[model samples]
Structure formats: structure tokens, C-alpha cells
Target chain A: MQTIDWIVLIGALLFIVIYGTWKTRNQNKSVKNYLKADDSNWFAIGLSVMATQASAITFLSTPGQAFHDGMSFVQFYFGQPIAIVIICLVFIPIYHRLNVYTAYEYLESRFDQKTRTLTACLFLIQRGLAAGITIFAPAIILSAVLGWPLVWLNIIIGVLVIIYTVSGGTKAVSVTQKQQMAVMMGGMAVAFTILIYALPKDINFSNAMSIAGAGGKLNVLDFSFDLENRYTFWSGIIGGTFLALSYFGTDQSQVQRYLSGKSLRESQLGLIMNGFLKVPMQFFILLVGVMVFVFYQFNASPLNFSPVATQAAYESEYADEYHKLEKELELNFEEKKLLAMEYGLASENERAGLKEQIVLADQKEGDLRNQGKEILKKANDKLEIKDRVEINDKDYVFIHFVLNHLPRGIIGLILAMALSAAMSSTASELNALSTTTTIDLYKRNVQDKSEDHYVKMSKWFTLLWGVMAILFASVADLFDNLIQLVNIIGSIFYGNVLGIFLLAFFVRFVRSNAVFIAALITQVVVIYGWWVDWMPYLWLNLFGAVLVIILASILQIFLSKDSN
Target chain B: MSPETNEKNGPKIELTWQKVFTWMLVANLIYVLIFYLIMKTFN
Candidate 1:
């Protein structure tokens, strides 16, 4: 990055930290103020909620996902609006009525301490692990593509979050998120505009989209009932709904965002805002990725986007074979470019003919790219690094565009956009993790503590979780994709927690013992199901929630009869 | 019995539960149509 880029990146980050700390410097003297920030308005709460969920992974890998697969992934959020509606009607009122610090505290009132503690522990495990992955997601990609040290990247992101979050607590997370969201959206808008202008003059937006459609990136919604498909319309609506309900309803990370609202009306309105805006915002981000895909069609792209894998291949004995694939790929790109130009001007019938040619050319290029990956894997196997480097190239696609194509100062702004997203999410996660730990675990176990004492403990716990997240990030490895990995982690545990909350709310007779045992059995079953790939990860949320509700109700009858 | 209207300020429901829900369903329908049109126009 040039001097201008550094100025933009550092300047944006420093502004967030100083602003967050400055805003909430004296407001957090009590547990309620530190943990809930009960004065937050609807807009701050809504932005914080959105910012918490849209991590660096969302900004970085989502476009790559759209580029490689298609826009079908947008269907993944089809359930979220319904989920938010359900939460507004059911979940939000309960938490607000109880005036609880964390979601689990209500479980204690309805069930027993065991059930509440059990659910809180589940959140701690899932969210604690997610906190690390959120930091690692952007750090690993930026480190790989920018040649920055991974450990330092992790530390820089983690420490920035820890400073503000530890200083001002929940209020810190809320206030800074508004600024971070501004930087994030501003940077993305700038990137999108520049990308459009960067495209070939003849290829207007419509033509560019046609090229993308011919390549199959515009298949936004698939109504297929196939269970094996992960992002079908049904799966997105049903499975995505359950996931969103569990996440926003039961999970303290999201619940805490709105729990800070100045009034019940404000909190509900904030969530409603999220429900209204989340899908379109995601669609816009995915469109940016689709546009990047269109940009690459006219330009030369790497055979594989992963820099480390390609570097390893270049240094190994397979270098000659890799170069051969590169030459073949270049020739293939030239052919496809010509075919695309023909496609741009063709009539309806003629366009169909050109699309077939374009798809065929695209398939051949994909085959060559796969062949290149195989060679790179073989090359890496010979190296001392082994599996330390990722061979899959999807995560690297968007960052590759940013570094290679975006202008100097804008590159820094985009990088700031990425780091801002990282900080916003990690701060929320760390803040949530610490809040749950203090209220549900520490304060519950060690009673009669002063308000000041608990506030101090909250800060210390935030620091500890921040350190743990950084440590986990430093050692974290890439899975299929960073975004999916975080969701999969949430899916594994979220369904069970959501189930417990559902039983507490809707089924009044299901007592603590039955629900607790049912949750244990369901967790084991869900983990086993995920292990064997029972369904796509999204459905796990539905599966776990349904299982717990069913098992708990049945167990409640048996246990109640026994007690009588 | 609706959770949304069970408030002391309950009788003055500004955005009624029914209306808000209808809006959600309607918005979703519009989004689906727009997405389908984008697909048809390009493909």
C-alpha cells in the first residue's frame, strides 16, 4: 500500500477507537450501563445488530462466493425476515419485560439455574470459538494476499477491538459500530463505483450482467426441493429462518444489541429495521462480487487466486506443468473474451448459441484451474509447510481484485472497510462473550458483588476473551470458506439453545429437568448429524430446535407422571 | 393474546401486528419478483 492508503486505513481505525471511547467514557459505572447500555437508540441498535453479524468474512468472502458459485447464495437470507418478525412478536417482549442483562437470565427464571447455566455455557462455547474465527477470517486472507505477518495482523485487529470494548463495554460496541458501518458502506460504495468504471467501455452494466448470466452467476433463486442443495429457496426460507430466529432470538450477541434500546419500542423497531434492510444489503454486497466476476471476464486472472499455493507451486518441481496450465488458461481467456463480445451484440436466437459457446469455454477454463490446483497440492505436499497453506482459491478472489485493480488511496479505504468490519464484529462478539460470562456465570455464582466490582470484572473478562480470540485466530486454519465456517459453528449449537428458549416461552409445562436432559441428547444428536452430513449446515438449526422441543415435551410428560 | 399488543399503551397500537406482518410478506413477494426479473432480463 502507498502512503495515502496507510493514511486512510489508520485514520479510519483511529477515529473509531477514539470516538467509541470518547462517547461512552463515563456512562458505564453500573452493570446495566456497562452490559446493556440502556440508552441506545433504534438506529444505533439496528446498525450494531447488522454490524455484529456482517463480519469481515461477509465483506471479503461473500463476493468470492457469488463469483465462483452464483447469486443463489442470497437465498440463504430468505428466512431472516421471517425470523426477525417472529422475534419481534415473541422473543423481544419477553427479554424486555424481564429487564434481563443477558438472554440466559430469563431461562433461570423460567426453568432452573441448571438450564440457564447450561444454555449460557453452550453460547460461551459456540460464540467463544466464533470470536476467534471472526478475527482470523480477515487476518489470514489479508496476510496471504498482502504479505503482512499473520500473527501481527491478528494482534492488530484483536487489540483494537479489545481497547474500545474493554473501555466502554456494550455502549462502546454500539457507538463505534455506527462509524464502522459508515466506513464499511462508504468504502464498498467507492469500490463498486470504481469497479463499474474499470470495466470495458463497450460492456455496459446490462451487457456485463448478460455476460455474468451466460456464465451462470445470476441464478438468484432456486425453488428446487432437493435436500442436498444448501442454498435452495426452500432451504433458505425454512432453514435460514430457523437459524436467524435462534441467532437473533436466543443468542445474547444479537439480543444484547437490542436489549440496550432506550425503550421496548426502540428495540423492536431496531430489529424490524434489520429485518427490512438485511436482505437488500446482502444482495447489494453479493452484486459487488458478481460485478467483480464480470470484471475478471475481460481481464487476465490467475490460474488459482491463492497466493501461497501459487507461490509454492512456482518454487516446486511442478513449476513447468503449472506454467503450461497458465499458457492454456491465457489462450482460453482470449477465446472466451471474443465469444463474450459476440454474445454482447447477438440477437435472441444467436445469443443462445453464443451462450452455449461461452459456457463451454468457461467449463474448459474451470477444468484447467482444477488441474492447476491439483499440481499446486502436489507441490505443497513436497514442501515443509504441508497443509498450512490453503489450496482452495474462493476466499482470495475479492481481495485479489482489491489489491490488483483498485487505485492507491481507494485500496487503503477498502482495506479500512475490511478492518472496520472486523473490529465491529469482534468487538460485539467479545462484548457479548464477556457479558454472558459475567452475568450468567460469574455474578450468578458469586453473589453480593458491588456494581463497580462487576463492571471491573466485565472489563477483565473482555480482555481475557479478546486475548483468547487473538490466540485462536493466530492458530486458526481455513475451512471451505470463512463465512460458512462461522455459520456452521453457530448452527451446531444455536438450534439447541433456541429449542430451550422455545420450550420456556411456548410450552409452560415442560419443566427444567426434562428440558435440560433433552437439550443434552439433542446436542449430541445434532453434532453427530453434522459429523455425518445429515443435512446442510443451515438445517442443523431447525433440526436441533425441533428435536429439543419434541424431546423435552415428551420427557416432561414422563417425568411429571413419575413425580405424581 | 398477541405478544405485541399486550402493553399498558396497548390500545394505541401504531403499527399493528397484523399490518407489520403483512408488510413483511408483501416486501418478500416484491423482492422475489424483482430477483426473478433480474434473472429473466439477463439470462
Candidate 2:
């Protein structure tokens, strides 16, 4: 990036941090202030909730996802609005009534202490690991593009987040998040507008979309009930809804957001706002990707988009073979582009005649690209199985375009947006993790401490989790679809967690032992079901909830009869 | 305030019809505009 862009990027980031710290400087000194912002209003809590969920993975990988996979991924959010309604009606009132710091606190009130501790431990494990992955995912990309060491990049991002988060706590997270969301959305909008203007003259927006549609990149909805297809409308609605419910309702990272509201109504409004906004925001991000896909059709894209892989291939023995294939692919793209343009301009009868020929040429080009991928894979296998492997799927395409094609200052802005997403998400996770650990585990089990002591311990826990996240980020591999990976990790535990909460809320007759044992069995069975591939990941949430309720009810009846 | 008084206040009702309707309208309008833009630009 140019000096001007670097200056702009650094200035924007520094301003956000300084602004957040300044705004929250006089925040009260108590556990309530640190964890829940002492019950703030709708706007602060609302924006923080949104920013926490919109991680670096969403900004970095989403556009690339759209570029490769098309817009069907938006289906994954179809169930979110419905899930929001459910939370508002059931989850919010109960949480407010209990006056708990974490969602698991309610589990303790309704069921046994064991159930509460188990649920909290599950959250810590899943969220703690996820915090690390969130930091690691973007750090890897920034390292690759800027040639910085991954370890240093991880520490830089993680430590910056830790400083503000440990100092200002929840108030800092909420305040900084408001600005982060604005910058993230504005940067993305600018990037999308620039991408459209950069397209070729003949390809106006509509025509470009038509080309994308013809190439099957505009398939946004699928009603198929297939278990294996990850993003079908059914999976999104059913599986996605359960996942969203568990996430927004039971997850402490989200619970803590609403808990900071001055009233229950404000928190409900904030969530309802999220429920309504999330789907469309995702749709727009994915649309930019579809446009990127069309842009690449007119331009000559690389056989592989990963620079590391591409560089390794170029330096290997297969360099000459790869070069020859690249030249042929370039010619093929030129011929296909001409055919597509002719087809676009043709009259009805003329179009009918040319359609088959155009499709045939397109198929041939696709096959040639596949052939080139195979060559790269083989060469990579020979060079070093671990280091030289090329696993380029669809998610790397947009980033590759941005780093190579966009102007200097815009590049820096995009990079800052990515870092902002990572830092915001990681900071929220660390904050939530610390709150759960201190309140659910330490305060409850250890010697009762004063408010000041608990507050100090919270900061120490935040620092510890932040360091742990940096360590995780430095070591993990590049996940192809990071958003999906994070959700999948959540699904494995969310079902059981949500199940425990369900039992606590509705099944009053069941004793603590029954519910606890039922949860353990449900978790094991759900893990087994997922391991054996009996159902897709989304169904696991539903399974976990239902299994715990049924098993707990039965166990309660049987155990009661035996005691009598 | 005592815990009983806090409970009697019943979580402080802020759910005004005007506010709810305003948010609903704003949210729907935003969705419509997004769809219009996508259809206009990409269709």
C-alpha cells in the first residue's frame, strides 16, 4: 500500500481505540459495569451485539465465498429472523427475571448447580477455542499478503484487543463496536461500488448479472431436503434456526450484550433489529462476490488464487508445464468472452443457434482449468506434502483480487476492515469467556470476594484468554470456509447447551440428577450421531434439545418411582 | 429500592407501540431498498 493509504488506515484504527477508551473512561467500578455496561440503552447494546457476531471471517471470507459458491449461502440465515422472535418471547423475560450475569446462571437457578456448571464449562470450551480461531483466521491472511510472520500478526491483533478489553471491559467492547460496525459496513459498500465501476464497459450491472445467472452463480434458494447439502433452504430454515436460537439465546457472548440493556424491552428491540437486518446484510455481501465472479470471467483469473500455492508451483519442476497450461487457458478465456458477448447481443433465433456452441466452449474451458488444478496438485505432492499443497476452493478468490487489483489506499482500508472484524469478535469472546469463568466458576465455587476483587479478577481472566487466543491463532491452518467452521464447532456443543436450558425452563417435574444425567447422555448421543453422519449438523441442535427433554422426563419418573 | 419493589416494577416496560412500529417500518424499508438495488444492479 502507498504511504497515504497506510496513514489513513493507521489513523482510523488509532482514532477508534482512543475514542472508545475515552468514552468509557468514567465507567463505574463494579462487576455490573464491567460485564453488562451497567444496563445501557438500545443503540449501544444493539451495535455491540451485531459487531461481535460480524467477525473478521465474515468480512474476509464472505465476499470470496460469494465469488466461488454463488449466493445460495444466504439461505443459511433464513431461519435467523424466526429464531429472534423465539428468543424475544421466551429467552429474554426469563434471563431478565433471573438477573444473571451469564445465561448459564439461569440453568443453575432452574436446575441443579451441576447442570449450570456443565453448561458454563461447555460455553468456555467452545467459545475459548473459537476466540482463538477468529484471531488466527485473519492473521494468517494478513501475514500471507504482507509477508509478516503469523506469530507476530497474531500477537499484534490479540494484544491490541486485550488492552482495551481488559481496561474498559464490556463498556469498551460495546463502545468500540459501534464505530467498528460503521467502518466495516462503509468500507464494504465502498469496495462493492468500486468493483462494479471496474467492470468492462459492455457489461453493465444487469448484463453482468445475466451472465452470472447463466453461469449458475445466482442460485439463491434451494428447497431440496437433502441431508448432505449444507446450505439448502430446509437446512437453513431448520438447522440454521436451531443454531441461531442457541447462539443468540444461550451463548454468553450474545447474552451479555442484551443483559447490558437498561430494560428488558431495549434488549429485545436490539435483538429484533439484528434478526431483521442480518439476512439482507449477508445477501448484499454475497452479491458483491457474485459480481466478482462475473468480473473474473471477462478478465484472465489465475488457475489458483492462493499466492503461497501459486508461488510454490511456479518455483517447482512443474513450472514449465504450468506456464504452458496458463497460456492455453488465457486463449480459452478470450474465445469464451467473445462468444458470451455475441450470445448476449444476439436476437432470439440467433441466440438459440449460438447457445449450444457457447455452452460447449464454456465446458471446455472449465475442464482445462480443472486439468491445470490437477497438475498443481501433483507437483505440490512431490515437492512437500505439507508445505506445497494447493487446496484452493472458492473463498480465496475475492481476497486475491483485492490484494492484486485494487489501488494502494483502498487496499489498506480493506485490510483495516479485516483487522477490525477480527479484533471486535476476539475482544467480545474474551470478555464473555472471562465473565462466565469469574461469575459461574470462580465466584460461585471459590471464597466469596468483594465486588472490587471480582472486578480485578475479570481483567486478569481477559488477559489470560487473550494470550491463549494469540497462541491458537499462531498455530491453526487456513480454514477454507471459516464462517462454516465456527458454526460447526458451535453446533457440536450448542444443542446440548440449548437442551439443558430447555429442560430448566419447561420440565419442572424433573429433578437435578435426572436433568444432569440426561444432558450427559444427550451430549454423548448427539456427538455419536454427528460422528456417524446420521444427520446434518443443523439437526444436531434439534436432536440435543429434544433428547434431553424426553430422557430427563423419563428418568425423573423412573427415579421417583424407585425412591418411593 | 428493595428486591420486592424491583420485582413489582416488572422489568420496566419500554415497549411502546410507536417505537415498535417505527423499527418495523424502518427495517422493512431497508429490506425493500436492498432488494430494489440488487434487482436493479444485478438483474
Candidate 3:
């Protein structure tokens, strides 16, 4: 980044922070206000909810996902719209009627205090770790791009979130989220347009899409019944629905968003809006990735997208061998690019002839790239690599492209967007984590306090969690797919949490001890099942929910019969 | 029936619009399931 870019980046971020603090200055100084924001309206609540879910990972990793894997990842969201509808119809009204602060608060009323605390603890653990990962995702990317120390990047990102979130609480998060969502969506649109325009002149939007299609990047749906397959139609609808329900309905990070709505109707509307728009929004984001993939096909792309890895390779004794491989890869890319252009212009029969050539070329390129990765890995092994030795995945591709290709001012804007996404998500997670801790544990178990005291504690808790997130972010290394790691974390706990909620709501005759014990057994079983690889992670949510309800009901009968 | 009883028993309709809408929503959801399955088969 140039001096101008640095100035623009810092200026944009400073303006956002100052603007958020000023807007939420008059937020009521009470626990209710700090945690729930007294039930706001459709626009504020809806946008804040969306912003919380749309993390920096969504922007940073999704385009890279598209660039490498193509659009099939979108199939995972096919069930989200329906899941939102389910939450709206069943989850919203019940939660609103209960008048609960945290989702676990109702668990106590429905079952026992033990059940409530257990569920709340589950959320705190899962979300606390997730908060760290969310911060880590963008911090690692920015560190790689700027050559900054990961520790400093983590602290800078974590502290900025802590400042506003600790001061303005939920209201501050909601207000700034509204602005952040606007900026994120607008930035994405601008980035997509630029990507399309940057493609070769003869390859218009349609031709670019055709190139992507030919490369198998446009396979958005897979109907295979195989249990091993991750993103199939069946898994997406069944498993994805359960995951979404667990996420939006039970998780405090999401439940807290809707719990702040002014009326039951407004909250329902906000959730419905999410259900309606989320899939299409995800589709648009993935489409941007597809275009980026197309952009690279016509242009020369690096053997490895991670600059850090490339730099390390250059420094190693394998420099000559790596340069030779790079030259060979470039030659292959030029060859494939010509074949693709010919296929694009040729008639049906001639195109068929060129198609095989293109496929052969693509395979050759893939083999060369894999070989390059092997060489890089070997070099790192020999050098006594201490950290950051993993092969960089497709997630960093889009960010690298932006940093290297985009112009000065626009580069800064994109960077600011990445920071905004990271902060928006981190703020919401910290805010929710604090709300769950303070409400579910501290206020309920530790001691009762005045509203003012609770409010003060909430702020303190937010700051503490923010620091914890920074610490976690500093130590964590980049995963092959950072976004999938986030989802996998959610999958581990969501089923068990959702199961506890399901037992509470529907199993009226089940007593507290039975349900609580069943929940404990169910959680252990779910985690064990995941560890042993009995089923894919997506199915874990359904397994957890069903196991709890079944076990709780049977336990209720047994315990009651025993008392007789 | 007495006058009070008659007044209390106003409109003994079997199904109201709200009930119909609820059923409609369920039917629509069922349709979505079928549509998804079909798309899976063909696409």
C-alpha cells in the first residue's frame, strides 16, 4: 500500500469508530439496554442480525472458495431460507412471549436451572472460541499482505472492537452494524464490477461466465445421496436446516439480535427478511468469486497465491528449481488461455475439438501447481519451519488479488471493508458472549445486583472477552478453509444446544433432572460421534436435537416410574 | 337457545381465514420440498 492508501484506510476506520460512539452515546445505562437494546425496529435489528452472521471470513474466504472450488458451496445455503421461515413461525413468538434476556433464560423456565446453565456454558465456549477465530481470519490475511506481526494485528483489531462494544453495548453494535452492512454490500458490488471490467476485452461478462462454466465452477447443486459428500441437496436441506435453526434460533449471538425488536411482529419480519434474502445474497457473493476465477483464467496466475510462502521459497536453496517450475507454469497458462479463446470463438464441432485440449491443459497446470506446493513444503521442512508452514488454500486468493491489482484509493476502501466486517462480527460475538456470561452465570448464579451494577459488569465482560479473542487470534494458524472451520465449530455444539431447546419446548411432561441428564448424555454422544466420524459434521445438528428429545422423554418415564 | 347463548354462539364456522392461511403455508412448504427434489433429479 502507498502512503495515500494508508491514509485513506486509517481515515475510513477512524470515521466509523467515532461515528458509532457518537450515535449510541445516549443508550440507556441499564443491563437491559446494554444486552438487549430494548427491542429495536425492523431495519436496525434486521441489518444488525445480518451483519453479525456476515463475518470477515465470509468476504475473505468466500471469494477464494469460488475461485478454487466454484459455486457448489452455495448449495449449503439452499436450506437457509426455509430455516429462517421455521424460526419466524415457531422460534420467534415463543422467545418473545418468554421475555428472556438470553435464550438460555427460557431453558430454565421450561426445564431446570441446570439445563439452562449447561446450555449457556455450551454457547459461551463455542462462541468464545469462534470469536477468536473470526478475529484471526482477517488478522492472518492482513498480516500476510502487509508483513506485520500477527500479535499486533490481533491486538489492533480486537481492541478497536472492545472499545465501542464495551462503551455503547448492544445499541452501539446494532447502529454501527447498519452502516457496516451498507458499506460491505456496496463494496462487494463495486469489487465485482471492477473484476468484470478487468477481464480481457473480447471476453465480456457472458464469455467470462462461459469460461467459468467450462472449468466446472458453475455446479451449484449436487444431488448425490452419499453420506460422505458434504454439500449435496439432501444434506443442505436436512442438515443445513438444522444447523441454521441451531444458529439463528438458539445461539445467543443471533437470539440477542431479535430479542431487541420492539414487537413480536417486527422480530418475525426481521427473521423472515433474513430467510428471504440470505440465499440470494450468498449466491451474489459466490458469483463474484466465479468472476474472479474467470479473471485469472485469461491472465497469468502465480503458482502459489500466498506471498509469504513464495517469499520463503525464494529465500530457500530451492530458488532455482522453484523459478523453473514457475516459468513452466506460466507457459502452460498461456497455452491454456489460447485454447480457451479458440473454444470460445469456434463453432460447435471445432469447440468440441478444443474442449479436450483445454481439459488436458488444465490437468497439466493442476499437476504443475501441486508439484510446486510439494517443493515449497520440502523447503519449509528443511529450514526448521516453526510456524505458518501450511500450504495456502483458495481463501486468500481474492485478498491477494485485491491488494496487488486494485488501484490506490480503492485498495484502501477494500481494506477498510475487511476491517469493518471483522469488527462488526467480533463486536456482536463479544457482546453476545458477555450477555450470556453476565445474564446466565453471573446474575443468575453468582449474585444478584442492581441494574447499574449489571450494566457495568456487561461492559467489563465485553472487554475481557475481546482480550481473550485477541489472545486466541494471536496463536491460531490459518486453516485450509477458514470459513469451513468456523462452520465446523458451530456444528460441534449447535446440535446439542438445539436439542436441549427442543426438549424444553416440546417435551412438556419431561422433568428437569431427566432432561438435564439426557442433555449431558446427548452432548457427550454427539461429540463422540463427531470425533469418531460416524457421520459428516452437517448431520451432527440433527443427531444432537433428536437424541436429546428422545433420551429426555424416555428418561422422564423411567424416573417417574422409579419414584412410584 | 336463550338470547345470551345465541349471542355467544355467533358464527359457528368450521374454518377461518387464519386457519386457511396456516394450512396454505404448510402446503407451500411441502411444495418447496417437492420442487427441490425435482431439481435435484433433473439438474
Candidate 4:
């Protein structure tokens, strides 16, 4: 990175921190102001929700996902709009009417105190672990790419978020997210434009589309009922809806985004905005990645996108084997490039023959890349620090593009954008964690506490969670599989919680005890399911919700029989 | 702030919500269609 890059990166980050802290600095820091600071317009709520959900991974890894796997990942969001509408219709009005700080608080009203506390603890366990990865996901990726130490990067992201978040609490999170969204989207848009212009002048957008089509990169929908497939249209709608419902309706991070709205209507409208725009936003990001794939098609791409992995491969005894694979990759890329250009220029009829040839060439390239990955893995066996090196290169592709391809200031801006995404989400998680802890646990158990005392405690708790998150991120490498566990942590708990909420909302007769016991059983079953690899982790959300609800109903009937 | 609408603010929230929801579902249908179109055109 050049001097201009450093200036842009540091300048943008500092501006967000100072702006967020400055903007909410004047709030009186009452409990409402500190934890549930309302008065966000719909647009602000929309952006906050979007920013909170889109961690650095969304920016860093999603394009890579598209680059390799194409746009079928967009199907993962098909359930989003449906989830949003359901939340607006049922979840928002009740939360508004009851005036709760966190989603778990509603359980106490509908069920008993134990159920609420149980759900709150489940949330703390899942989200607290996830908050660590919210920082570490980007830090590890950025550290590897930039050769920066991971500890410093983790602390930098965690502390930057803590500064503004602890300064003003919920309002600070909502306020800073607007600017964060702007930077993320603006940086992506500018990068996309530059990428398009970087393509060969003869290849117009239509011809570029043709090239992508020939490479089988433009696929957007898969309606198959294959349970083995993760992103088919059916799984996306049925399973995705369950997970999103758990996320938006029951998860406090997202729930808090709309809860900060100025009014019930504002909150509803805010969610509506998210429902409508989430898919298109994801589609646009995936489109940028497809363009990156196109960019690489014309340019010479490495056998592996991760430099450290490639370096390790070179350093190992397998350097000769790696070099041979690289040579083959070069030959294959040259052939694909020429074939791609011809396919781009080919007419409608000519494209079929060219597309078939290109697909075969693409398959050969993939086979070589697989061989390269095998060599990289074998090379990694010699590394002293095995966990830090990512053998798979999916997360590195987009950043690799930004670093080697983009001009100076924009690189910094894009890096800043990714870091800001990390900060934006971490701030929201800390804010929500602090709020749930203060309201659901502390205040609920220790009654008669003054709002001032609770508010003070909330601020301290935010700082505490933020520090823990940084600590987790710093030591993340110790647990080689921690990232994978954290990724599924939310879905594991989400199913039971969503079921409890759905019972509360719909099943009037299932009382607190039955629902509470059913939730506990469902949780144990869900954990066992995850342990056994019962199905894909995301489907656990659907399975858990259904299991808990059915168990609760059956228990309710049996308990009623006993009571009679 | 029209005077007639101002008087209806008490119950104003949900009158248009169902309509909005219906339209929103329609929009999702359109999204599916557009995605299908992309697949059909490109793949």
C-alpha cells in the first residue's frame, strides 16, 4: 500500500470514530438513552440493520464465493424478505407495545422469568462467541494479506468500535453505521466501475456477460430439491426463512436495530426497507465478484490466491511439484483466455460450441487448481504455524484484487471499508450484549436498581464484552477449528429460541413451563444433532424450531391432563 | 399532514400494511422471476 492508501484508510476510520463519539456525546446516558436510545428514522434503521449483518466477511469473502462458486450463493438470501415481513407484522408490534430492550425480555412477558433468562443466556453464549469472530474474521484475513500481526489488528478493530460504542451506546452504533454503509457501498461501486473499465475495451458489458456465461459463472437460481445442496432455491426459501426469522425476529443484534426506530411505524418501515433491498444488495456484490472472476480470466491468476500459502509451498520440498502445477496453470489460463475472448465475440449459435469447449477447459483448470491445493496442503505440513495459513483461497480473491489491482487511495478506502464493516458489526454486538445483560439479567434479578445505575453498568458491560472479543480474536489461532464453530454458533441456538418465540406468538395454550422444558430439551437435541452432523448446520434452525414447538405442544397436552 | 389523515393517526399503522405486504410478496415473486430470467438468458 502507498502513502495515499495509508492516509485514506486511517483518515476514514478516525473520521468514523470521532464522528460517532461526537454525534452521540450529548445524550444524557439514561438507561433508555444508553441501551434503547430510540429516534432513528427508517433509513438509519435500515442501514444499521444492514451494516450489523454485513460483517467484514461479507465484503472480503463473498466476492471470493462468487468468483469460485458463482451467484448461487445469492439464493441464501431468498428467505430474507419473507423473514423481514414476518418480523414487521408480528415481532415489531409486540416488542413496541411491551417496550422491551432485548428480544429475550418478551419471553418473560409471554412465559416465565426462567424462560427469559434461559433464552438470554443461550444468546449470550452464542453471540458472545460470534462477536469474537466478527473481529477476527477480517483481522486474520487482512493480517495474512498485509503481513501485519494479527493481535494488533484485532485490538485495533475492537478498540475502535469500543470507543464510540461505549461513548454513546446504541445511538452511536446506529449513527456510525449510516456512514459505514456509505463507505462500503461507495467503495464497492467505484471498484466495480474500475473493474469494468479494466476489462479489454472491445468487450462491452454484453460481451463480458457472454464470457461469464460461457464459463458458467452467471448461474443465479437452482430450483432442485437436493437436500445435499446448501443453496438450492428450496433450502433457501424454507431453511433460509427459518434462520432469518431466528436472526431478525429473535436475535437482539438485528432486533435492536429496528427497536431504536423513532416510532413503531418507523421500525416497521425500516425492516421493510431491509426486506426489499437485501437481495439486490447481495446480488450487486456478487456481480462485482463475477466481474472479478472475469478480470482474472483475462489476467494471470496465481495457482493459489493466498500469498502465504503460496510462499509456504515454495519454501517446502514440494516447490518443484508446485512449479510444475503453476506451469500447467499458465498454459491452461492462456488457452481459456483465448477461448474466452472468442466466446465473448461468438454469436448466439456459435456460443454453444464455444461454451462447451470453454467448460471443458474450465474443468481442466479446476482440476489443476485442485492439484495445486493438494501440493499446498502437503507443503503446509512442514509449517510450524499450521492454523494461521489458509490452504483454501476463497477469502483471499477479492482482497487480492484490491491490493494488486486497484490504484492507491482506493485500496486504502476499500481496506478501511472492510475494517469499518468489522467495526460496525462488533459495535452492534457489544451494544446488544450489554443491553441484554443489563436489562434481562441484572435488572430482572436485582430489582429496584435505579435506571442510572443500570445505565452505568451497561456502559461498563459494553467495554467488558468488547475487551473479551479482542482477547478472543487475538488467541483465535490456538483453536484451529474455532472459526467453523463460531460460524454455526448462531444457527445452533437460533432454532430453539425462534421456536420459543413462535410459541409465544402463536400457541396461546402452551404455558411457560412446557415451553421452557421443551426449549431445554430441544437445545440438547440440537447440540446433539450438530455433534452428529444430522444435517447442514443452517437447517438446525428449522429443525430446532419445529422440535421445540411440537414438544411444547405435546407436553402442554400431557401436563393439562395431569392438572385436570 | 392532511386534516382527514391527521384524524386517522390513531389506527393509521396497519391500514396500508396488508397492502404493503401483498406488494412486497409480489416484489419477491418478481425477484424470483428476474433471477430465473438471468439463468435462462445466461446459462
Give each prediction's DockQ, rounded to 2 decimals.
Answer: 0.43, 0.16, 0.06, 0.37
Residues A1-564 of candidate 1: C-alpha lDDT, one tens digit per residue: 999999999999999999899888996779988888888777888999999999888899898999889899989999998988888878888888899989999999999999999999999999998899889888989998889998999999999999999999999999999999998899889988988898887878888889989999999989989977889999889878877888899888898999998778778878888988888999989999999988888899999998988887888898999999999999999999899877876777889888989999999998999999899778767756525457888888989999999999999999999999999989989999999999999999999979999999999999999999999887765343455677787888988999899899999999999999999999999999999998988779889999999999999999999999
Q: List the residue pairs that clash in candidate 3.
A: A39-A260, A39-A261, A40-A260
Clashes of each: 0, 0, 3, 0
Model 1 reproduces a share of the real contacts of 0.51
User: Which model is ahead, 1 or 4, in terms of DockQ?
Assistant: 1
State the TM-score, rounded to 2 decimals, of chain A in model 4: 0.98
Off by over 4 Å in 1: A347-349, A381-388, A477-489, A525-540, B1-13
Question: In terms of TM-score, which candidate is stronger, 1 or 4?
Answer: 4
lDDT of 2 by residue, A1-564 (tens): 789778867877887788877787765388888877756777677788889899887887888787766787888887777777778767888888888889998888887789899999989988998998888878777677678798888888898898888888998988888888888888888888888888777767766776665555677766788876888878887878877888899999998988888777777778877877788889888888887777777788887777776777688888888888788888888987886677655555676566666657667766776777787778767864336554564546777778777888888788788888888888889999999999999989977688889889998999999999888776666544454666676777888888887777667788889989998998888888888988777667777888988999999999999999
- Tell me the spans in candidate 3 whose CA falls farther than 4 Å from its real position: A316-318, A346-350, A380-385, A446-448, A477-490, A527-540, B1-43
Model 4 lDDT tens row, A265-324: 778878888888988899999999999998988999999999988888888899999999
Instruction: Give one digit per residue, the lDDT tens place, for model 3 in A1-564.
Output: 888878877887777788888887766477777788855776677788889999987988898888877777776876676677667666777787888888999888887788889999989988998999888888887888788898898888898888788888888898889878977897788889999898877778766766776676777767789877777878878767777878898988998888888766666656666765676678788888888887777888888888888887788888899999999999998898887787666656565667677768877887887888888888877864354354755767888888877888788778888888999999989999999989999999767678888888888899899999998787776444454666676777788888877776666788899988988898889889988999877677778888988998999899999999
Query: Which DockQ-derived CAPRI band holds candidate 4?
Result: acceptable
Worst 10 residues of 2 chain A by lDDT: A384-393
Give candidate 1's error at residue A161 in angstroms. 0.5
Q: For residue A147, what is the lDDT in candidate 2?
A: 87
What C-alpha lDDT, on a 0 to 100 scale, does residue A275 get in candidate 4?
Answer: 85
Clashes of 1: 0
Interface RMSDs of all predictions?
3.2, 6.2, 9.2, 4.7
As a whole number from 0 to 100, the lDDT of residue A247 in candidate 3 is 85
State which candidate, 1 or 2, has the greater TM-score.
1
